[model samples]
Target: MRMVAVIAAAALLTASACGSGKNDTPPPATVEVFTWWAEGGEKAGLDALVARFDADCPGQRFENGAVAGGAGVNAKQELTRRMARHDPPDTFQAHAGAELLDYIDAGQVEDLTAYYESWGLRDVLPAGLIDDLTVRGKIYSVPANIHRANVVWTNPAVLAGAGITTPPKDLPAFIDNLAKLKAAGVEAPLALGRDWTQLMLLEAVLITDLGPDNFAGLFTGRTDWRGAPVTKAVNDFTTLLGYGNLDRDTLDWPQAERLLIDGKAGYQLMGDWAAADLEAKNFPGYGWFTFPGNGNTFQWLADSFTLSTGASNITGTECWLKTVSSATGQQLFNEAKGSIPARVDVPSSGFSPYQQSAMTDWKSATQVPSCAHGSGCSQAWQSAVNAALRSYSTSPDPATLQAALAQAATQFVRP
Candidate 1:
């Protein structure tokens, strides 16, 4: 990987020198940035990157290719169709690890170790984020932003209404508080979308409260899914699901956001980016707490761009990756994206208070690639988790969900 980066850097230097020596007119290239960031906080960040790229890389037109869906659902499916037809965008978004792994397997991405090395990322990028982007010592993607997933967005009024004084610090207390809210006649203790968002919320709780080391172990094929810790997480998630609104299955994150926006729900466990949407709604005076956990460590996932091999324009595509991962670009991108840049060296002045706090927690913590959320686990495991938990929208059966979780945990060991 280091050798590939060295050679690529040398090649870029040679190309730059040779190009600089010539007065030959180069044609402008059209670059398309495909991503699942078409609304609220995500849209802002995507626009910021495009604007910066347009300003710096003159004549490089960015095709606005934003698809609306949770966890890159529509975009990933769209990418498959494009790759099949040999027609992919100049750049597209992916969660660093498993998503990129699939593309690398299909020979659909460029090795970005050179770009990473050129930016001196070994020293500047956060180690956790770097590890997530790397596979077998090689890098295939550029991290755009660190989206911390373990936040519990709470409505202060709702919590007060339920007579809960402070955020719960452990799983047992956490569950008890939600029960309090439910008994207080709160329609939803957790403002869940009752789809993948519910699953994401559950994973956040399990990872943060359960200890990141134990959380990491689960996916690396070390932890036993049939055991108490994993079972507790399943039960906790199902119990939270026990407090959901009957119509949750139809709600997207935004609709769920609206509930918190209107002070209709007591708490919603989601990423910090959800706060960005709250900010946009001019919703005021809400509180965000780390999903109460036994440990103080945090876990995160990064959203980044992966160039498709089907890109017909290499120069444009190369430049796209180069500028997006640049220090200035990372800052601008994360600022608009409602998160922080993956680069550790970037100044932290341009973010909101919630983002600033999340960054502080992020600095002191560990990060793991989000398996079910971003890693694009196997279709079987994803379906199993979905099938197992989907019923929780109404059922909330712990035993049934636990059995399903145990069965699905077997899917991740690559060997």
Candidate 2:
């Protein structure tokens, strides 16, 4: 009987050990996604992508580490801090071109070339875009969406009230319209925001004064910043700024956009993302046009995702990247994001009319990279330009600003 009791006790002990072993198995990993999409249409787009991730990446939890700031100014600062401390998120949003070169040079991101092949991304994304994303023949990130930076959003009622029936076709006409709107009792005829928004305005004016090739050449050191064309662009930029809000420096893009939305301002020069914001707010009858004189050119930027080198959840990170690059994921995100899918295979049937128009333009327009959005210039270069503009904003010295910009290009432009 004692022997029988010993056997039963041993069996019970074994059963308890087995149960404990089962309980000790680790839970699925959570993906910590870092971005600067904390509000408005950008946030909604992210949320939709997260929902898709939940369905496709089952067993993985999604953690949002979004920071709030227009143009990712705050988020990029925070990300720089985190990366310096070696606390990288699983995946982070990055502009696909020169901005990503900083991380690549630092060896902070992984080479995604093999994954691209496995996922057949090479076949789906545009060949020109693939060339732009590639650095020394290796791609480091996957593009999520393509955004047009030179779009001008207008409040139709404000325009009609100012007796403006058609959009301006050139810089002279644009300035004339601004004057007309101001004379019609609008306090701020052109909506302006922080430094980046101003930088965008400057770039649009450059395209107008310099034409597509010369404007693009400015980044490559082929166009002279000290020349007459750029000077004309700077003068035009200043003229346009005169009609902007007196309190512009304190406002973010969304706040500036609100000026147009509420019918206080006639036009806002911003990215295509404003369309999504307008849709989200249920604002209708909004009008859009390419920045005056940028009619045949598309100033483009792409929001992409990078795989951090030391990500805590490699599986989850890979899952997130795959989902973001997939056609369905791009469709879901772009439909609500006010941008077009990076993948060419994604259909355009469900996108907003503005987006559909942008899609057409994307195919036929002369595409150029946007310095304000980190495609045409490096982060350091962008910062330098922003500093110059900020000082110019307060002091309004065109010569001094032009000199500073030329110095920045000399320092940051690569051979």
Candidate 3:
């Protein structure tokens, strides 16, 4: 009987051990990444990023929650709904500067100050970028890539066809080049998309007209919106629009780029993301340069991911962020995305010639926040500007546009 009792006790202990083992099994890994990168090179870059995450992070299933719209319009709208319902994704894409402040203000994002330190990012990223990303002594997102917004992409073959032997060096040269291209039978001398693309072009014009400091001052209340500098920018933008495609109001940036790629247009002034798209197409003889008269300045925008406050898979989200923050991941993703890695320490050998040039410029160029891309101004301010520009495009009047923009700025520009 004592022997029987000993066997029974051993069986009971085995059962308890089995139960504990089952209870200790790790929960299933899942990560949902949200972004507005739904097509073209942006999607390709995102796929490369997810593939890296899949390879490095075993057993984690990644969910791509991509929404399509220009400048993250649809994605932000959907994200607003999700955040309101308290059902946030593991991570969401956001522009890295004042744009991120909105999420921080709503307490919808987690503080990543500790992660930045632990990951040694503080040493790798530019000090100015770090300061821009930080607010109230804490950072809230991880920037993946830096894009230059003041770039002009030209098809060398088209430029040559248009009797242009050399790219333009300054604003007057650019205008003359457009005239040459038009005389050479080009319908669209300057390819432009809808509202935001016009706004992007306007920002570059503003920089050339106002210089980097005053261009920045527009947001800080240091520069007068109704002053001569802004007035000149508005006039230049109106003149530039005269060279734009007839269907400028109908096409998105991608469609506008198609005009340049097909040799129907001589130049496309857009962010470096367009370069990535061109690279993906393997279109040879394409060249890039900074906006006219703004060679020394970098109108910058960055794509960053923020940790959501209600993330159901914090571990998986952190794993994804760590992977993106790694050098290998940055190189792979940036190669596909047509942008430079945020980490200045990353090797530039993997980048294309255009990207290599951009990286070199990024190191020494005077950095200016891209107002159209959500870095230089608040969302409200940006929206107001966008509205004013849309109306300005329809009217194509400099004086009226200046007045409207100044009124909009007064309403929203806090500083």
Candidate 4:
């Protein structure tokens, strides 16, 4: 079946170029695809996509340009440097929403509205997602998958040992469970990682304390940052931080996930990508629940690929984008990545249990974007929030953190 698809793709590639006088120049031999999927489940997903690219575009080599970091924290800095030097990769991974605004504003990424029309993507991709990918009526990237951010991955055995039969439904209940887990000999009842992971936890707590509408409003200036609800959320976040590991400042999400996988911690609040990692490592009896107080809401983010404005290999880059936007590519990538396909037409028959549930929730739940994952706000706004979080992590002062956040909104949030 795979071979047949490859042969068909090759025939289509040949037929499409036959009548065009523009085919005088041979296509580039290799396409350098840049991303931060350097390890664990993220890497597995990228590997699957690369395999699909190899099969579908047999003439073009797939050059891996992966940089290591959680949430592309390090990779974004590297990408900035590359872009400044006018050496951007053929295509690079980016978050699908407000994050792409930076590149779009700078004219660093090509307008992909034409590509979307040509590929009939508007027919298959969710309308909400296409809207998220657009800025000034032009889409700049092709989203690969939709990841739910408000998930609490659990070690079921650890919870059972702590005398907790069911997952917590609210912040207070969750805190109580943490206490029980700690009393039952768990070192860190909540496993947390550095900057963005901590930010993700805070966002989940925001959803709990403010509700989905209010939390989403925080990004759009519809909700005030100085409101009592935000203050309460921050306090709740600080309280939860106390139950996390002391080494959190030094670790990334994958290390924090290991704490739960090894039973040293009771839960890890993360995106559904953790499911892929747990499955990859063959960790048994792992379970998941929506983060406490986040019922019926899906806090979401999308990983997307953008074609550079002056990409050295337009043919190779378009080939990569086409493969990424296809249902087959989305199926292979999302199944391995523990995300649901961005394309609504992709079937959920063989996805993991967590992904299947996520797909259902994706359709019915109230959806909100993730600030930590760059969907809810601009990169500058997210950076300002992260700065506040870094200071709060060390000082544990809720008031100071709240002040910093309000100030960030003043500086960055548009009317």
Best by lDDT: 2
Model 3, span 264-356: residue lDDT tens: 999999998887788677775788888999869998999999889989999889999998888888998999888899888888997888889
Question: For model 1, which pairs clash?
Answer: 45-336, 45-337
Residue 192 displacement (Å), model 3: 0.7
Question: Global lDDT of each model?
Answer: 0.76, 0.90, 0.88, 0.89
Winner of 1 and 2 under TM-score = 2
TM-score between model 1 and native: 0.88
Where is model 1 more than 4 Å wrong at Cα?
A: 1-27, 375-380, 391-397
lDDT of 2 by residue, 1-415 (tens): 9999999999999998987996777787899999998887788899999999999998799999999887898999999999999999999999988888799989999999999999999998767678777888899998999999998999989999989989897878989999999999997899999898999999999998899989988988999889999988888898999999988888988899999988899999999888888777788688999998886898889999999999999999999999999999999998878899877777789988998888877766788889999888889999999999989878999899999999999899864
How many backbone clashes can be found in candidate 4?
Answer: 0
Task: Give, for candidate 3, the lowest lDDT window spanning 10 residues.
Answer: 406-415
Expressed as tens digits, the lDDT of each residue in 243-281 for candidate 1 is 776687888877887887776788888777777777788
TM-score of each: 0.88, 0.94, 0.92, 0.90
**Clash number for each model:** 2, 0, 0, 0
- Mark the 10 consecutive residues where model 4 has the least summed lDDT: 19-28
| Candidate 4 lDDT, 1-415, residue by residue in tens | 9999999999999887785667665764889999999887788889999999988886798998999977898999999999999999999999989888788888999998999999999998767677666777888999999999999999999999989989887889999999999999999999999888999999999999999999989987899989999999999999999999999988998899999988999999998888877878899589889999988999889999999998988898899999999999999998877889988788889997778888888877888899899888889999989888888878888999999999998888753
